[model samples]
Target: MSHSEQTIEREIVSKGLTAPRLTPTSIDEAIKDEHYWVAPGRRLTVCALTLRNGFIVTGESAATSSENFDEDLGRKIARDNAREKIWQLEGYLLRQRLHDA
Candidate 1:
Protein backbone atom coordinates (compact mmCIF):
# COMPACT_ATOMS: atom_id res chain seq x y z
CA MET A 1 0.00 0.00 0.00
CA SER A 2 1.02 3.65 -0.29
CA HIS A 3 2.57 5.68 2.52
CA SER A 4 -0.64 7.44 3.47
CA GLU A 5 -2.47 4.17 3.46
CA GLN A 6 0.16 2.51 5.66
CA THR A 7 0.04 5.41 8.06
CA ILE A 8 -3.70 5.15 8.30
CA GLU A 9 -3.47 1.44 8.95
CA ARG A 10 -1.01 2.02 11.79
CA GLU A 11 -3.19 4.67 13.30
CA ILE A 12 -6.22 2.39 13.19
CA VAL A 13 -4.34 -0.47 14.80
CA SER A 14 -2.88 1.84 17.41
CA LYS A 15 -6.38 2.98 18.29
CA GLY A 16 -7.34 -0.67 19.09
CA LEU A 17 -9.85 -1.03 16.28
CA THR A 18 -10.53 -4.14 14.25
CA ALA A 19 -8.01 -5.00 11.57
CA PRO A 20 -9.43 -6.62 8.50
CA ARG A 21 -7.15 -8.91 6.55
CA LEU A 22 -4.89 -7.25 4.01
CA THR A 23 -5.96 -8.36 0.58
CA PRO A 24 -7.27 -6.73 -2.54
CA THR A 25 -10.69 -8.26 -2.18
CA SER A 26 -10.77 -7.62 1.56
CA ILE A 27 -9.79 -4.01 1.16
CA ASP A 28 -12.34 -3.58 -1.59
CA GLU A 29 -15.05 -5.01 0.60
CA ALA A 30 -14.08 -2.86 3.58
CA ILE A 31 -13.76 0.34 1.57
CA LYS A 32 -17.16 -0.15 -0.02
CA ASP A 33 -18.40 1.63 3.08
CA GLU A 34 -16.97 4.97 4.13
CA HIS A 35 -16.75 3.86 7.74
CA TYR A 36 -14.63 0.84 6.89
CA TRP A 37 -12.29 2.66 4.57
CA VAL A 38 -9.74 3.39 7.24
CA ALA A 39 -6.68 2.35 5.25
CA PRO A 40 -5.50 1.73 1.75
CA GLY A 41 -6.14 -1.54 -0.06
CA ARG A 42 -3.38 -3.33 1.85
CA ARG A 43 -3.92 -2.18 5.42
CA LEU A 44 -6.51 -3.86 7.58
CA THR A 45 -8.81 -1.95 9.97
CA VAL A 46 -10.81 -3.55 12.76
CA CYS A 47 -13.71 -2.70 15.06
CA ALA A 48 -12.84 -1.73 18.61
CA LEU A 49 -16.18 -1.67 20.39
CA THR A 50 -17.96 -3.96 22.76
CA LEU A 51 -21.70 -4.61 22.42
CA ARG A 52 -24.02 -3.75 25.27
CA ASN A 53 -27.72 -3.24 26.03
CA GLY A 54 -28.67 -4.14 22.47
CA PHE A 55 -26.93 -1.06 21.12
CA ILE A 56 -23.67 -0.71 19.20
CA VAL A 57 -21.45 2.28 19.62
CA THR A 58 -18.44 2.54 17.36
CA GLY A 59 -15.11 2.81 19.11
CA GLU A 60 -13.27 5.17 16.80
CA SER A 61 -11.73 5.41 13.33
CA ALA A 62 -8.24 3.96 13.19
CA ALA A 63 -7.13 6.29 10.44
CA THR A 64 -5.68 9.67 11.29
CA SER A 65 -4.15 12.19 8.93
CA SER A 66 -0.71 13.76 9.32
CA GLU A 67 0.06 16.20 12.12
CA ASN A 68 0.66 18.93 9.57
CA PHE A 69 -2.65 18.13 7.95
CA ASP A 70 -5.52 20.56 8.27
CA GLU A 71 -7.07 19.84 11.68
CA ASP A 72 -10.48 21.34 10.92
CA LEU A 73 -10.82 19.55 7.61
CA GLY A 74 -9.65 16.28 9.14
CA ARG A 75 -12.09 16.62 12.02
CA LYS A 76 -14.99 17.21 9.65
CA ILE A 77 -14.18 14.16 7.59
CA ALA A 78 -13.58 12.06 10.70
CA ARG A 79 -16.96 13.04 12.06
CA ASP A 80 -18.68 12.00 8.87
CA ASN A 81 -16.79 8.72 8.73
CA ALA A 82 -17.52 8.00 12.40
CA ARG A 83 -21.21 8.70 11.90
CA GLU A 84 -21.37 6.34 8.99
CA LYS A 85 -19.58 3.61 10.97
CA ILE A 86 -21.86 3.98 13.97
CA TRP A 87 -24.91 3.74 11.75
CA GLN A 88 -23.56 0.67 10.05
CA LEU A 89 -22.81 -1.05 13.35
CA GLU A 90 -26.23 -0.07 14.69
CA GLY A 91 -27.90 -1.60 11.68
CA TYR A 92 -26.02 -4.84 12.20
CA LEU A 93 -26.86 -4.95 15.88
CA LEU A 94 -30.53 -4.19 15.20
CA ARG A 95 -30.73 -6.98 12.72
CA GLN A 96 -29.14 -9.38 15.18
CA ARG A 97 -31.51 -8.28 17.91
CA LEU A 98 -34.51 -8.74 15.69
CA HIS A 99 -33.38 -12.23 14.84
CA ASP A 100 -32.82 -13.07 18.48
CA ALA A 101 -36.18 -11.60 19.47
Candidate 2:
Protein backbone atom coordinates (compact mmCIF):
# COMPACT_ATOMS: atom_id res chain seq x y z
CA MET A 1 0.00 0.00 0.00
CA SER A 2 1.01 3.56 -0.64
CA HIS A 3 1.76 6.04 2.15
CA SER A 4 -1.73 7.57 1.98
CA GLU A 5 -3.36 4.15 1.92
CA GLN A 6 -1.36 3.09 4.94
CA THR A 7 -2.36 6.24 6.76
CA ILE A 8 -5.99 5.61 5.97
CA GLU A 9 -5.75 2.04 7.18
CA ARG A 10 -4.10 3.13 10.38
CA GLU A 11 -6.81 5.70 10.96
CA ILE A 12 -9.47 3.10 10.55
CA VAL A 13 -7.85 0.74 13.01
CA SER A 14 -7.20 3.56 15.44
CA LYS A 15 -10.82 4.56 15.42
CA GLY A 16 -11.82 1.04 16.28
CA LEU A 17 -9.26 0.70 19.04
CA THR A 18 -10.00 4.10 20.56
CA ALA A 19 -13.78 3.90 20.43
CA PRO A 20 -15.43 4.30 23.82
CA ARG A 21 -16.70 1.12 25.42
CA LEU A 22 -20.30 1.35 26.58
CA THR A 23 -21.69 0.25 29.89
CA PRO A 24 -21.62 -3.44 30.81
CA THR A 25 -18.76 -3.60 28.39
CA SER A 26 -17.02 -6.85 27.62
CA ILE A 27 -15.70 -8.80 24.69
CA ASP A 28 -18.72 -11.04 25.07
CA GLU A 29 -22.45 -10.54 24.60
CA ALA A 30 -22.85 -9.00 28.00
CA ILE A 31 -23.51 -5.81 26.16
CA LYS A 32 -25.74 -5.68 23.12
CA ASP A 33 -25.94 -2.11 21.85
CA GLU A 34 -23.62 0.49 23.28
CA HIS A 35 -23.41 4.11 22.17
CA TYR A 36 -20.76 6.69 22.87
CA TRP A 37 -20.72 10.29 21.88
CA VAL A 38 -17.16 10.98 20.80
CA ALA A 39 -17.67 14.60 19.81
CA PRO A 40 -20.54 16.95 20.48
CA GLY A 41 -21.50 17.52 16.88
CA ARG A 42 -18.78 15.95 14.84
CA ARG A 43 -18.92 12.27 15.58
CA LEU A 44 -20.78 9.56 17.49
CA THR A 45 -19.53 6.06 18.20
CA VAL A 46 -21.34 2.79 18.84
CA CYS A 47 -20.53 -0.86 19.36
CA ALA A 48 -22.26 -4.21 19.38
CA LEU A 49 -20.99 -7.31 21.13
CA THR A 50 -21.93 -10.88 20.39
CA LEU A 51 -20.76 -14.45 20.94
CA ARG A 52 -20.70 -17.18 18.33
CA ASN A 53 -19.59 -20.73 19.06
CA GLY A 54 -17.67 -19.59 22.14
CA PHE A 55 -15.94 -16.78 20.29
CA ILE A 56 -16.58 -13.13 21.04
CA VAL A 57 -16.93 -10.55 18.31
CA THR A 58 -17.47 -6.79 18.33
CA GLY A 59 -18.76 -4.29 15.82
CA GLU A 60 -18.08 -0.55 15.99
CA SER A 61 -19.16 2.57 14.18
CA ALA A 62 -17.91 6.14 14.17
CA ALA A 63 -20.49 8.37 12.60
CA THR A 64 -19.65 11.85 11.32
CA SER A 65 -21.90 14.74 10.42
CA SER A 66 -21.29 18.38 9.64
CA GLU A 67 -24.43 20.26 8.67
CA ASN A 68 -28.00 19.48 9.64
CA PHE A 69 -26.90 17.31 12.51
CA ASP A 70 -29.43 15.06 14.18
CA GLU A 71 -28.54 12.93 17.16
CA ASP A 72 -30.95 10.14 16.34
CA LEU A 73 -29.90 9.91 12.72
CA GLY A 74 -26.26 10.17 13.63
CA ARG A 75 -26.60 7.31 16.07
CA LYS A 76 -28.38 5.14 13.55
CA ILE A 77 -25.75 5.84 10.93
CA ALA A 78 -22.96 5.16 13.38
CA ARG A 79 -24.47 1.82 14.33
CA ASP A 80 -24.79 0.84 10.69
CA ASN A 81 -21.19 1.78 10.06
CA ALA A 82 -20.10 -0.29 13.04
CA ARG A 83 -21.99 -3.28 11.78
CA GLU A 84 -20.22 -2.96 8.44
CA LYS A 85 -16.89 -2.87 10.18
CA ILE A 86 -17.81 -5.93 12.21
CA TRP A 87 -18.60 -7.84 9.04
CA GLN A 88 -15.25 -6.93 7.56
CA LEU A 89 -13.45 -7.93 10.73
CA GLU A 90 -15.35 -11.19 10.87
CA GLY A 91 -14.30 -12.05 7.35
CA TYR A 92 -10.68 -11.22 8.07
CA LEU A 93 -10.71 -13.27 11.24
CA LEU A 94 -12.30 -16.23 9.50
CA ARG A 95 -9.68 -16.11 6.78
CA GLN A 96 -6.91 -16.02 9.32
CA ARG A 97 -8.41 -18.93 11.21
CA LEU A 98 -8.64 -20.98 8.05
CA HIS A 99 -5.06 -20.18 7.15
CA ASP A 100 -3.83 -21.14 10.60
CA ALA A 101 -5.85 -24.34 10.58
Candidate 3:
Protein backbone atom coordinates (compact mmCIF):
# COMPACT_ATOMS: atom_id res chain seq x y z
CA MET A 1 0.00 0.00 0.00
CA SER A 2 1.08 3.57 -0.54
CA HIS A 3 2.07 5.83 2.34
CA SER A 4 -1.14 7.80 2.10
CA GLU A 5 -3.16 4.63 2.07
CA GLN A 6 -1.41 3.34 5.18
CA THR A 7 -1.88 6.64 6.95
CA ILE A 8 -5.57 6.64 6.14
CA GLU A 9 -5.90 3.08 7.36
CA ARG A 10 -4.25 3.93 10.64
CA GLU A 11 -6.40 6.97 11.13
CA ILE A 12 -9.53 4.94 10.54
CA VAL A 13 -8.45 2.32 13.06
CA SER A 14 -7.43 4.94 15.57
CA LYS A 15 -10.92 6.39 15.42
CA GLY A 16 -12.33 2.96 16.26
CA LEU A 17 -13.70 2.60 12.77
CA THR A 18 -13.09 -0.29 10.47
CA ALA A 19 -10.90 0.41 7.47
CA PRO A 20 -12.82 -0.16 4.28
CA ARG A 21 -11.32 -2.31 1.59
CA LEU A 22 -10.87 -0.77 -1.84
CA THR A 23 -12.75 -2.82 -4.36
CA PRO A 24 -13.13 -1.28 -7.77
CA THR A 25 -16.07 -2.19 -9.90
CA SER A 26 -16.23 -2.32 -13.69
CA ILE A 27 -17.81 1.11 -13.83
CA ASP A 28 -15.10 2.51 -11.58
CA GLU A 29 -12.41 1.19 -13.90
CA ALA A 30 -14.13 2.69 -16.88
CA ILE A 31 -14.49 6.02 -15.19
CA LYS A 32 -10.83 6.04 -14.24
CA ASP A 33 -9.79 5.50 -17.83
CA GLU A 34 -12.17 8.16 -19.04
CA HIS A 35 -10.73 10.52 -16.47
CA TYR A 36 -7.07 10.00 -17.00
CA TRP A 37 -6.14 12.63 -14.48
CA VAL A 38 -7.86 10.66 -11.76
CA ALA A 39 -6.43 7.58 -10.12
CA PRO A 40 -6.47 4.48 -12.29
CA GLY A 41 -9.11 2.78 -10.19
CA ARG A 42 -11.79 3.39 -7.63
CA ARG A 43 -10.84 3.90 -4.00
CA LEU A 44 -14.27 3.32 -2.59
CA THR A 45 -14.43 3.32 1.18
CA VAL A 46 -17.20 1.70 3.17
CA CYS A 47 -17.79 1.36 6.89
CA ALA A 48 -20.06 -1.09 8.68
CA LEU A 49 -20.89 -1.79 12.29
CA THR A 50 -22.82 -4.60 13.94
CA LEU A 51 -24.89 -3.58 16.89
CA ARG A 52 -25.24 -5.67 20.02
CA ASN A 53 -28.62 -6.83 18.81
CA GLY A 54 -27.14 -8.13 15.54
CA PHE A 55 -28.29 -5.16 13.55
CA ILE A 56 -25.88 -3.91 10.93
CA VAL A 57 -25.28 -0.35 9.76
CA THR A 58 -23.15 0.92 6.91
CA GLY A 59 -21.73 4.04 5.30
CA GLU A 60 -19.83 4.61 2.07
CA SER A 61 -17.84 7.32 0.29
CA ALA A 62 -15.49 7.64 -2.65
CA ALA A 63 -12.68 9.90 -3.84
CA THR A 64 -14.19 12.95 -5.48
CA SER A 65 -11.24 14.88 -6.89
CA SER A 66 -9.47 13.77 -9.99
CA GLU A 67 -6.29 15.40 -8.80
CA ASN A 68 -4.92 15.57 -5.28
CA PHE A 69 -7.43 13.04 -4.05
CA ASP A 70 -6.92 12.23 -0.39
CA GLU A 71 -7.82 8.71 0.63
CA ASP A 72 -7.63 9.70 4.27
CA LEU A 73 -10.25 12.38 3.83
CA GLY A 74 -12.52 10.08 1.89
CA ARG A 75 -12.27 7.37 4.49
CA LYS A 76 -12.90 9.79 7.30
CA ILE A 77 -15.96 11.18 5.61
CA ALA A 78 -17.36 7.76 4.96
CA ARG A 79 -16.74 6.59 8.50
CA ASP A 80 -18.31 9.67 9.92
CA ASN A 81 -21.34 9.23 7.75
CA ALA A 82 -21.62 5.66 8.90
CA ARG A 83 -21.22 6.59 12.52
CA GLU A 84 -23.93 9.20 12.23
CA LYS A 85 -26.29 6.71 10.74
CA ILE A 86 -25.54 4.25 13.48
CA TRP A 87 -26.34 6.82 16.12
CA GLN A 88 -29.55 7.75 14.44
CA LEU A 89 -30.62 4.16 14.36
CA GLU A 90 -29.62 3.61 17.92
CA GLY A 91 -31.65 6.55 19.03
CA TYR A 92 -34.69 5.37 17.16
CA LEU A 93 -34.39 1.85 18.50
CA LEU A 94 -33.94 3.06 22.04
CA ARG A 95 -36.98 5.26 21.77
CA GLN A 96 -39.06 2.41 20.46
CA ARG A 97 -37.88 0.12 23.22
CA LEU A 98 -38.74 2.71 25.85
CA HIS A 99 -42.14 3.34 24.34
CA ASP A 100 -42.93 -0.36 24.38
CA ALA A 101 -41.78 -0.73 27.93
TM-score of each: 0.33, 0.41, 0.50
Which candidate achieves the best lDDT against the true structure? 3
12-78: candidate 2 lDDT, tens digit per residue: 6777765333211122233244544646556544444443443333334444445655567666665
lDDT of 3 at 29: 24
Per-candidate count of clashing residue pairs (backbone under 3 Å)? 7, 1, 0
Superposed on all Cα atoms, the candidates' RMSDs to the truth, in angstroms, are: 13.7, 12.7, 13.4
Q: Please, what are the lDDT tens digits per residue for candidate 1 over residues 6-46? A: 68778877888863334322333333233332344322343
Comparing 1 with 3 on lDDT, the higher-scoring candidate is 3
In terms of lDDT, the poorest run of 10 residues in model 2 is 22-31
Stronger candidate by lDDT (1 vs 2): 2
List model 3 lDDT by residue over 1-101, tens digit each: 33554686678668887433331221122221110111355566665645555555566777664454566775666655655555455556556777797
Report the poorest 10 consecutive residues by lDDT, candidate 1. 23-32
How does residue 55 of candidate 3 score in lDDT?
A: 59
